[model samples]
Target: MAYLFSGDGGDSDSAVVPLVCLQPFPLLLFASVPVCFILSAALVMMMKVPAFCYWFGCLFCAGMSAEMKAMAMTILYVCCISFLSFSLCIISLLWVFCSVFSAFFLCFFWVLLIVRDCLVFVWGAKIQSETCSLDSP
Candidate 1:
């Protein structure tokens, strides 16, 4: 009971690590820390540049009043956000799905697919709105 419940006994001279400390759970947790950080960094990178383009195109494009620019920006954001939400949900479903039976690498493929589709979407919408605004009477 002493070894399981307490960290040290009267013979505290032992150099060995504790049984609990040597478990795989701790190792897995520490291992997952870097993966979490990497995943977060990737999400940030995914959002950042699109944000830059969103702002730049909305603010810098000529012949648009503040209201129109705001509306276009809102539309762009809605589309991007909806697509992201949908993709993540799909990924979550996929995670439950194939993680039960197969390798984890398929998630990456879906992520790439979403990223490509999102980029295409956001940029296409941005361009289309800008063109329509320019073509307006």
Candidate 2:
């Protein structure tokens, strides 16, 4: 696990750094915060559409024998309910997919940031040691 953060040479000192310290707060903030806002906006937009019940009622209630009208209305009611439920299910699934994708990228961005910091730290230490050695001779 630590090796993932430590650069090429596998330094034990780098491995000693706690995993918790490497967690990047900015990645989580950047990934989830905007997604939450966007999801809320989308939910609001979804809710603003007029309900299908009124439209279905009006369309299915006209011009038929009483028995035929009853039967047709029942079928239309079921169909409209099914279509609305299916659309809701699809929207729910899409929200879940977007959240999961954001989480994945959050972890990815955190790891990249940690690895970058480790590399810079290692390079700076190397430069300092080289300059010290040159001065000693």
What clash pairs does model 1 have? none
> For residues 1-137, could you state the per-residue lDDT of candidate 2 as single tens digits?
44244443665554344443344543454465556556555544443444422443656445556687556556655655565566556556766665677568658766876887788889999999999999996
Q: Name the weakest run of 10 consecutive residues (lDDT summed) in model 1.
A: 1-10
Please give the TM-score that candidate 2 achieves against the real structure. 0.54
Residues 1-137, candidate 1, lDDT per residue (tens digit)? 11222222434532333444334344454465566556655554544453544544544646667686567556656666675666556555655554443333434444555676677679999999999999999
Give the worst 10-residue stretch by lDDT in candidate 2.
47-56
TM-score of each: 0.34, 0.54
After superposition, candidate 2 runs with Cα above 4 Å error: 1-63
- Report how far residue 49 has shifted in candidate 1, in Å: 10
lDDT of 2 at 124: 96
